[model samples]
Target: MSSTRTGLLLVCLAGVLWGTGGLALEILRDHSPLSVLMVSAYRMLVAALALLVASVVLRRGPRLLALVRAYPGRSVAVGLGTAAYQALYFGSVTTAGVTVATVVSLGLAPVLLAVVDLVRARHRTVTRGTLRLALVLGAALSGLVLVSAASGSGAAVGTRPVVGLLLAVACGCVYAATTALGSTVLTSADADPLALTTVATTAGAVGLVPVALVGGGPFVTSDPVALGTLGYLGLFTMALAYGLFYTGLRTTRSGAAVVATLLEPVTAAVAAAVVLGERLGLAGVIGSVLILTAVAGLDEPGA
Candidate 1:
């Protein structure tokens, strides 16, 4: 496969791992007393530790340290961005319905990144290709709204309605910013993707420590299943998924990268149907197809 195809596959694989992570989180929630914040903290902490160990074993510890020293601000920004998106996403889901939160965050993020790219281009003007890309993204987002709204079973909306929209938008912005900054750090600092992932994830873990402690300590549970799921999330979802994501970002545009990751929600929807025995309604099926089509369209040259 070509380098571009390799990048696309890496991103798609990351999305799939993320879907499994969502499933693991749902299972953990049902099986334990851990709150979402606690699970997030544990996932980050464990993933960070695992990546740190890997870096040392692979003899990338010095490189990691060099990146940290050279791009301290970028490292902090990436970590904070990760924490911000996660917190904001949860807040949006709580404040709005899951359907609204999912659609708004997932749909807006790629658009935001695309806009950022347009703004950053010094000489490249928005051309026919940009317009076409916009239309594809719009179609995908509409389908996402249909799928997400119809998939839910009438959850209660929070009293403060506008807060949810704001949170979701913020989540999208943070996602875009972090993605662009992450790519910059990777290229400018010539950092190892896995080591950078460790640093950024560790920062996120540290940021969430306060919330995790206040929410409740002992994030780990005695249940074997829950422990196993947590390990999967840390090792596979965070460590492996983010590593691939960063690696792909080396060869992919940030906007295109976000578009590729839209597969994450699609994967989750399919996993829910197959693993949890939930049925995908007609809209859900159509929505999944539209998203896949949009991602596929992105594979064309110059897309």
Candidate 2:
């Protein structure tokens, strides 16, 4: 397969993996006394440790260190950005419903990124192709609204929606900025493919140290379910997910990359239906189609 296609597939899979995060984190919180910040701290710490082990096993530690030393600013920005956006997202999930939080934060990112893409290609902004791309984004966003509406049935739906919406918007903006910049710096020909993620996650884990101390929760869980959930979150959603995202960014446009990850909310909605016994009514079905269609539309040359 073409590298671009490979990148898209990898990013989409990352989105799917990320979709499970909110639910898993929520479950962990219920069983443990971990605060949002604490959980985020654990997440980054675990992801960093896992990547460190991978680097040791692969023997790329020295090269990655060189990359970090070579571009300290980029490394630190991406790392802190990762932690900030995640903590903000978790906060949004707490105040707003998960479905709503997911929709707002993830949905806003693609729109912001598309704007950047258009500016970068200003000469093409008035073309017919550009109009079609706009329509596709509109459809996808509309579908997301439907999905969000369909996904809200749990106790966490709306304790403080306004606060959640604000937090989510902040998360989206931070994430969009990170993706735009990260795509440029996270992939390098000489550095290990995992270099950027490893560095960023390690920094992020360190950045969250104060959070871990302030939030105060046991890192050691006796419950197997909580332990497994933590592993899934740290490994699948974070370490592996980000590795795939940046790798995909090597070939995919930032705008298309974020949009492809729109699958996240849909995946979350489905997980809700299956695990939480929530209903996916007609709106959910229609929204899913629209999102999938929009993602496919982006593959066209003009888009």
Candidate 3:
């Protein structure tokens, strides 16, 4: 298979892994004492620790350090932004229903990236294809809104719609910026994706120290199920998924990779239906289809 295809597959797999994270969070809510902020911190801490151990075992410590030293500001910015977005996303989930939070936050990322593309292309002649791509973005966002609406009807848990929307928007912006910054790391000479991911997680963990501590309490939990779930989140969702995502960036366009992650919400919806017995009504089905189509469309040669 082509490298591009491999990259897209890796990214799509990352998205699928990400979809399961919500379920893990739910488990934590039921069994763990960690607050949302603390959960984010622990995610970073565990992922960083896992990566560190792997680096030592694989004899890549020197290379990881080199990657960090080469792009200190960029690495820190990406990691810090990543942690900030996670905190904001969980905050939004509290204020906005999960559907609204996930859809809006993830939906806005591609739109923002497309806007950046348009700005960069302002000097060039506009083509019909570019216009079509813009329309695709609009459709994808529309699908997200539909999904959010369906979610409200089916299982609305949010109490503050306005606040949640704002937070979700903020999360999207941060997510977009962080993703863009992370792509830069791949462009650097002798870039190592594994090293970059290790550095990113480490930096994110350190960056969240103050905020996690401020949230306080609920930091320690003795429940084995909760502990195992937490480990799954860090190891699979953050570490493995992010590792694949960065590796994919080596071959995939950043914008396309972002769009490919639409699979995340779709995967989440399906998983909820199966695992949580959440019913995805007709509207949800339609929305998921639209999103899937949009995701596939973004992979067209020029797109």
Off by over 4 Å in 1: 122-126
**Candidate 3 local lDDT, residue 126:** 66
Best by TM-score: 1
RMSD of 1: 1.7
- If the candidates were sorted by their TM-score against the true structure, best first, what order would they fall in? 1, 3, 2
Summarize candidate 1's per-residue lDDT along 24-101 as a digit string, tens digits. Answer: 888988888888888888888889889989998999989889888999889878987998798898889888878778
* Every candidate's lDDT: 0.83, 0.84, 0.83
Clashes of 3: 0
What TM-score does prediction 3 earn?
0.93
> Against the true structure, what is each candidate's TM-score?
0.94, 0.92, 0.93
Over all chains combined, what TM-score does candidate 1 have? Answer: 0.94
Model 3: lDDT of residue 34: 80
Q: Please write out the lDDT profile of model 2 over residues 1-303, one tens digit for every residue.
A: 788888888888888888898679768867776566776777888899999999999998897889888888987788999898988887898788777777888889999998998888875438877887798789889888888777764445768989999999999999999998788785544555498899999999998867768666564566777777888889989999999988888888898999888888889888878887778899998998899898888777778
Name the lDDT value of residue 302 in candidate 3. 58
